[model samples]
Target: MGPELHYQMIISRTAELRTEAADHRRVRQVEAAKKERSEGGLRRSLFGKFSAA
Candidate 1:
């Protein structure tokens, strides 16, 4: 509607983008950590079974 309103909208959008990016990054970090833990557990279990055999 006005110049000030347009500027405010732009700033609001930038903030939303930053917040979304941070959330995405956190989700990825958590997923990667879980994957690493799962792989580590599998490796240990397999190693134990092989060693016993």
Candidate 2:
């Protein structure tokens, strides 16, 4: 393949890989936040029960 064609291919592939990585990172952050919220809620509930008793 011509050098220009090869260069273009590499650039496009790199861009696609970066996009995929960013999406994965966003998903992981969202999952972590959700887990933290759920754990926090559970802690609050347990604390409330203990305090009540």
Candidate 3:
């Protein structure tokens, strides 16, 4: 019973760590996409102003 309980605890802890790492990766991907979009918008605005002038 003691060894079985310890094994279960290790499994659960490993699963939690996996989930946290996946979440961190997903967040970084989302932030990178957003930064790219904003930069693209800035470039378009600048080009539009030059064209208008």
TM-score of each: 0.77, 0.86, 0.71
Mind giving the per-residue lDDT tens digits that candidate 1 earns over 1-53?
99999999999999999999999999999999999999999999999999999
Query: Which residue segments of model 3 deviate by more than 4 Å?
Result: 48-53
When summed lDDT is taken over every stretch of 10 residues in candidate 2, the lowest stretch is 1-10
Model 1 ranges with Cα > 4 A deviation = 48-53
CA lDDT, every model vs. true structure: 1.00, 1.00, 0.99
Give residue 39's error in model 1 in angstroms.
0.6
lDDT against true structure, model 1: 1.00
User: Is 2 or 3 the stronger prediction by TM-score?
Assistant: 2
Collision pairs in model 3 = none
Query: Which rank order by lDDT, best down to worst?
Result: 2, 1, 3
Give the C-alpha lDDT of model 3. 0.99
Q: For this target, which candidate reaches the highest TM-score against the unseen true structure? A: 2
